[model samples]
Target chain A: MMTQFVIRRVLYMIPTLIAVSIVTFLVIQAPPGDYLTTVVARLEAEGQYVDRGQLDALRERYGLDESVWVQYWRWITGIVLHGDFGQSLVYSAPVSDVIQERLGLTILLSVTTLAFVWAVAIPIGMYSAVRRYSVGDYAATFVGFIGLAIPNFLIALILLYVSYRYLGQSVGGLFSPEFVDARWNLGKVLDLLAHLWIPVVIIGTAGTAGMIRVVRANLLDELNRPYVVTARAKGLPERRLLIKYPSRIAASPIVSTVGWLLPSLISAEIIVSVVLSLPTTGPVMLRALESQDMYLAGSFLLVLSVLTVVGTLISDILLARLDPRIRYGRR
Target chain B: MVESPPPLLDVRDLRTHFATDTGMVTAVDGASFSVPRGKTVCVVGESGCGKSVTGRSILRIVDAPGRVVGGSILWDRDGTGDPVDLATLDPGGPDIRKIRGDEIAMVFQEPMTSLSPVHTIGSQIAESVRLHTDLDDDAVRGRVIEVLGQVGMPRPESRYDAYTFQLSGGMRQRAMIAMALVCHPRLLIADEPTTALDVTTQAQILRLMVQLQAEMDMSVLFITHDMGVVAQIADEVVVMYLGTVVETGPTEQIFTDPRHPYTRALLQAIPRFGQRRAGRALSIIPGSVPDPYRRPGGCPFHPRCAQARPGTCDVVEPATVTVAERRDVRCVLAAEEVHS
Candidate 1:
């Protein structure tokens, strides 16, 4: 029954994605700038273009000389079947290759952040709400408020400074000094982690604070729910009440929102990745935009959207399985 | 009739209050009651009368900002008649949680919210069993099927694995009962257990509870606003008003020859079939429960008591004068009315 529903949903996503690709192609084309002209003109200035025949042949090959509708149709068809996102105007690489190379870095960072966020925030939030006005709860709330106030990039800069001055080491730039000499092994991994600690802590601190507040508020509300009180009356142990009831109900909404959590993750990474000069998607996207690297930039955007949609879809499926009320069509 | 033993739960002078930003609000103010083994005691009152708070206070599940300032919840572990004061025990203390499910289990209202929507009912019920026992998987599964059958759920073998949402309201209530009584707890605290069910389901659930109690010889502390339910199941009745136990006695005596005016007024409020308060609406108690923040210094129910003497009733909190064996009422007029 559940599998049928998921299969149906996956089938439905096909047309929606086709529509998204068409929209992506048109929007990029309709914007009054033609990036291909600049590349061609720059090459011409360097005495690369010989005559009208050569220029026209080059334009036809990339589909720039064709009608806008024809070019769009060709691109759409390529994406739908062959999964070809087209070649880059500036970087001159296939769009998928660009996405492939950068996606791992972004996922590595975000997933790590996700783990730290939940682990630290849940306890802080639970105890804070449970304690309500105790010194610890208030202190945690105050710290969370600091994360809300300070911009993440500014925090990143401060962490970098701390690593350089206090620790007398350059850490925020990814891999430590040893990895510069050594290769990818146990020692290199440990060295990278040590140096990455400052940025991870800074970025993670703010992320953790946000999650802590979210978990705290959600948990507090769930605790006051009549069901929670009922669980208490049943003479269930404190451990049972917390783990079984409040945790699940309180977490549902946040869990449902995970698919959409990427924008914040990407935006947060932009500054941190830039400041540290990490070869992540944020920096790649920025450089692609500056150089009018159309294929790379477009490919990055497509990958991001797919990741978000897929994430949300996964969350929905899991939620349906966890909850009987979700109606996964028990057939 | 086979007489039951002494009360399983003996609460005395239960004073609970919240030290909120707005000074102190008395929640379960100086209330007292007893629930004998193998029987039901229904605590009935309007909302804000501290009926629910009294039940939670016994379990020490009162969330922060609300504390059990002073009280005694003397609970008997078995037929030994030795009562343990639960009010003095720390909420996180080992002794309390250890006995919570094994000896005393609670069935919360609204099976939907009480049962985790994420898990199967069998898994949830198994939690109570696993917490205090060392049963293997097959043993736990066998026990789950047995309890489901005991609660009168149809095809218990198949339904134990279902989640709360898959079951009907009546079935959910039974599942909740199954969860609470699965361990065969000596005492069960049922707070508004049937309020969420339909009339037919309520009757069935109540009867099932009574049957289970007789079979297991367990004590039940049933809290509800429905006097009809109270009349049906309760062996003893406690009438609460403004955080105080206004009247408490055997159910038959309290219903038939209600001594306290509040009890009389409450019974009178219960709708009859026809021609009973002819062409008149239910006689409201004239006023709502007093605000705990601005409570009367004397008898808390004086403002709403129809027979209250203006000066005297409003000036002094009456002592719980004994009217019969195991029957006491915290009302000055009980004696006066009896003599009259």
Candidate 2:
């Protein structure tokens, strides 16, 4: 049954992704902005105002002289046939190659932030639930509410000051200068991770406060489930009842919410990453948008959309596997 | 268990309550009962009547907002001679942990939610055996197959590896029973375990419980609001009111000579074959359960009770008094003793 569900999910993804790609291509190409104007503006800003001669040469060189329809068709065909995502006007490199170079760092930050969020948030959530109505739970809950109230950028700035005030040097930055100078060996990796930890924690901490509340609500619901009472009545150890039985029962809610978490994290990361000047996807994507770099903005959006769909698909498959109630094609 | 397995389980004054925002809801208000070896003790009540709460409290499963404020849950254990108090013991405590599968187990309502969807039945059952016993793989597998067979599940071997989604409602209930009885727990706490099953499946599951109880010499705390099911399974009947035991007696007496008006009303409320109209269906208790937050000043049910003598019953709480050798009821109208 699990295998069949996984297969069904995989089958569902093909059409969904294809539709997403088509929508992305059409939306990106049809918008008023094009790659040529942004490139011309960047040059003009650098006091290299393009003459009419140069503008014509630039337009023809990059295939921007073509009509929007022709340009989109060419872009789509090139992507399908040669995996070409076109050249970035800003970076002046293949879009795929630029993404490849930066993808690892973005994933590292996202993965680290997520892991940290779960690690800290789950415990707080459980503690709040376990110590319901207590002073400590109230305090933790109050702090969590505060987290919701304060934007990540403001929190990021506060953390940056605290780090700078107590600890010497640029503790605010994502990577250490030493790590950048050192080769990408184990020592450098470890150093980079240590430096990266601060920003990850800042983003993670802010994000998890809300999730802590959500997890608590979900767990409370599960705790009230009839099976939970039965498990307890069986004299199953408290550990088993809470973590094994109720937690598993409550998992799908937490798991399903992860899809929403992915998008939220991108925006939250935008706040923290911009404040800290981290080399994370959020800042890059924001920069691309602000600069009106259409190819870069479109590619970033396309990648993020794909990630969102894939995340949701993963949640669906997990739900099918974990929940006996959901049978593919059965209901 | 030396004293002939000592009533399978014994419970005394199990007072469980919830400390809610509005007020304390006495869920299992001083409930006390026992199931003799191989006997089924059905706790019957309305939705808010604490039948399920009592079962959960006995299992030491009362959660936040609800707690076993006072109680003693003594259960027969295979490895120990003396019965242990499940109430004070942490559910994760070693003694209770060891007893979960090998000496005591539970089955839940809504098999869809009761069984973890992520795990295969085989593994879930296997986990029970693995956690609670020192049995080897072959022994565990053997026991799983045997219990699955005992529950009347078809294709035990194939079904073990199957997820719950693959099973029919009947099969799922059987699988749940298999998980519960994997180690032949001396006592089984079944909380409306068959309410979600179809009529045929419900009958089958009830039969399986009765048969298994006898085979294992187990006590059963069968929680339900269904009088028909209560009639089918209960050796002893405990009828609860808002959150207290309104009446309790032997199954035969409780059914044939019910003293409490609530019990009488509940039993009559069950629809009879020829007693129903087309639009108006089953008879209902006069009113809904009193909201716990703003319960009536005196007897919680005084507002709806037929036997309530306006002045006396609408003003004071009734006490549990002995009606006969094995019967007790909390009714103001019961025959009172006169002092010289």
Candidate 3:
């Protein structure tokens, strides 16, 4: 039964991705002018005006002269058949090659941030709910509200100034100056780790606060449930009873949030990335859209949408595993 | 009757209070009762009477903002060992935990919500067994299945892995009973276990509980508002009003010769077959249970009692008086017998 469900879910993703790709293609096309117009305008501004013939040649070479349908067809088929996401008009390189390093770094940062969020939020949320209205709970609630209220970029700017001023240390980006262009090595990896904390903290603060509230609210609802009392009456220790019953049930919403989290790996914290000067996908995608680099921007959105679809599938499977009612389709 | 064995659980002046935002609301106030060994005692009361809280207090499973404030739950486990005051034990300490499911287990009212939806019945039942016993996995499973079968769960083997939502209302209650009984506790506190079920299912569950009580030789403290259920399963009855036990005696005696005005009013409220006339309405106790925060000065039931004397019953609290063998009533009218 589980396998069948998974198979069906996987099959459903095909049409979903197709629809998402078409929408992404059209939205990217809807804006006036193409990448060539920006290039021509830039050349003109630089006092090196291009002739119409050269501009038309450049447009033809990049397949920008084609209709929207033909262009979308080429792009989609190239991605489906050859895994080619077209060429990045801004970088003058293949879209995949341009994004490969940034994509890896983004995923690494997102995964670490997610881990930090869960590791800190879950225990604190459970504690807050279990000992509600206590001193510790009040403190957590106060801090959580602050975290949720402040913008991530403002937090990023403040942390950067603090570390650079009082600590006399620069803490921005995912690497120090020495390892900025260095090859993959133990030293570079160690340096990356040393510089990773700031970005992780800034990106994770809001999520952790939101997650804590979710877990606390969900757990509070479950704590007073009769099942919890039954478990307590069964002599289960306070901690075990909490983790084994209410906490497990309370985690369902958190599990379902994975669908949103996966896409955030590619597009979250855009302004923060720009402020910190981190070589992550968020900033690159931002520049691509601003420059009307349709191929690069469209590819980025398509990948994000696909991740969303796949992430939803993963969360559904996990939810089924966690709740037997969902797995058995029983009320 | 051949001399009954000593009471398995003795509760004395149990006072459980909840520290709500409004104030400290005393849910169970100075209530006293005892459950005789190997017999069923039903605590009858309307809503807000604190019958459920009284049972929860005995098990020390009252939710947050509520706790047993003052009480001595003397649990005589084997009828030979010195009774232990359960109320004094730290609710979360090891001593009380050791006693919670090993010697005393509880089944709650909502069978649907009282069992965790995420866990299978066998696993939930096995959890208690594992906590209290040294049984191996197979033995724990064996014991769980045995109890499930004893509780009349259909096809216990196949039903073991079923979730509570998958089971019918009757089956869910059976699963709950199985969970409570898996450890072979000396006492079982069932707080309105059948109140959520249909009438047919209620009868089946009550019958199953009675059968298991006999087979396991365990005392049961059943809490309910249903007088018919009380008459059917109770060997002894303790009627409570506004967190206080107003009358208590053997079931037959309480039914035949109720001494307290509240008890008599409660009995009169039950709708009997063929007793309803064309226009005459069924009798109901006048007034509702008083708010916990503003309990009346003298008798809590004075405003609701039919025979209350304004000067006497409203000014002075009535003391419990023994009017007959093994029967007690707290009422100004019953106090006259002691004076005589």
Candidate 4:
């Protein structure tokens, strides 16, 4: 059943991704001028405008002089046929190559942050809910509210200051100066991990806090339900009763939110990455959008949209596996 | 001389109170009853008369702000020795916990919400079996299927893996009863187990419970507000009014010669088959149950009783009087031994 559901989801994503690509392409090209105008303006500013013929030749070579529809058609056909994402006008390289350089670092950071958030949020939320109004619950609730109130970037700035002042270390970027452009070796990976903690912790705070509130509320409601009472009356121990019954039910909504979290985390990373100067796709995507590099920005947005769709598909499959009501189409 | 064996459960003056924000509300005030082996004792009352609270108190499943304040719940496990006072034991202590689902299981009122929606019915019943007995996985599955079949669930093997929401209301309740009976508990506390189901389902469930009780030789403490249901299943009847037991007798006597005014009112309130009712409104006990915190000083039902004497009934609470062997009534008109 699950395999069939997953296969159907995969097939459905084909048309969805096509629609997403078209919308992304149109929105990128909807702006006033193409990347060629910006390139020509830079050349003219540097006193290097040779002739109008040369400019037209450059536009034709890049296929920018064609209609917006023709350019989208050519770009999509190239993508489908040869696994190409076209050229990045901003970086003067292929869009796939540019994305390849930064995608690994962004995925690492986001996944690490997500893991950190869930690891810390679920237990604390369970504790606060089960022992609600106790001293520990009140203290955890206070800290959670503070975590929610403080912005991620502001937390990043504070961590930076604390590290600089007390620890005497410059913690910007994903790697230290020595390993900045190093090859893929053990030392470089270790250094990357050492510097990875700050971004993960800073980016994870708001998400963890929000998740705590959601889990606590959901669990509190579930704990009062008749099923929970029945479990208790069954002579099941406290912890087992909690984890096996209400917690499993409460986790459905939390799992369903996974689809939205990926894109939102990437967007949040854009702002925080710019502040921390991390070598991730966040700042690169921002720069592409700012300079109107259509292929670069559109390719990044397309990947994000695909991730959103895939994330939702994964969450749905997981929810189906976890909840029999949804799995059997009873709900 | 031959003496009778002890009852399975003897609840004496069991008072369960809730400390609400407004004040302390006494839900079960001096509720005393006993369930003999292989017999069904039904506690009948209106919505707020504390029937369900009594059931929950027996199982020690009352939530926050509500507790069994004062009483002795003497549970005679095997009828061979002295009874253990359940009220004195900690609610979650190992002794009570072992006895809760193993020896005294409870089936809640709303089977729609009683079983967890995410878990399969087999696992739920298997949980109780595993908790009470040290059975292997195969043995537990065998017990679960056996109980399901006993409860008249169709296709027990296939239905074992069905979720609660997938089953109809009657099936869910059957699954609930199966879950309760998997351990072969000595006493089953069924709190309105069929109230939320349709008439046909209700009859089936009640009949199933009676059949199971006889087959297992397990006593039952049945709580319900429906007198018709009481007539169908109860061997003995205890009528409650405002947290107090107003009458206790055989089911036949309670139906025929009710001594307490409240019991009489409750029996009359049941719409009979051939009763002529051309233009009269339905017979009802006038005035709802009073605020638990501000209960009137005399008989709790005096305000609504047609035979109430103003000076005596309004001034003094009625004392329980023995009308006959194994029959009692709390009414001033029946007897005149006021101790308080």
User: Global lDDT of each model?
Assistant: 0.79, 0.77, 0.88, 0.89
For all predicted structures, in order, the TM-scores are 0.90, 0.81, 0.95, 0.95
What are the per-candidate TM-scores when only chain A is compared?
A: 0.87, 0.87, 0.91, 0.93
CAPRI level of candidate 2: acceptable
For residues A199-266, could you state the per-residue lDDT of candidate 4 as single tens digits? Answer: 99988999999999998999998988999889888998888888899999999999998899888888
lDDT of 1 by residue, A124-212 (tens): 88899778889999899999999878887788788778767897877555676546657569887777666655556666777788888
- Native-structure RMSD, model 3: 2.3
Instruction: Find the 10 residues in a row with the least total lDDT in model 3 chain A.
Output: A262-271
In model 3, state the lDDT of residue A113.
90
lDDT of 4 by residue, B45-114 (tens): 9899999888899888898779999999999999975999999888877888898889999999998788
Docking class of 4: medium
TM-score of chain A of 3: 0.91
lDDT of 4 at B122: 94
Residues A200-279, candidate 2, lDDT per residue (tens digit)? 77777767888889888888777777666545544466776688877776677888876667767777777787788876
Against the true structure, candidate 1 has what lDDT? 0.79
- Tens-digit per-residue lDDT, A246-305, candidate 3: 999998999999899877644556788899989888898999988788789988888788
- Of the true interface contacts, what fraction does each candidate have? 0.59, 0.59, 0.91, 0.75
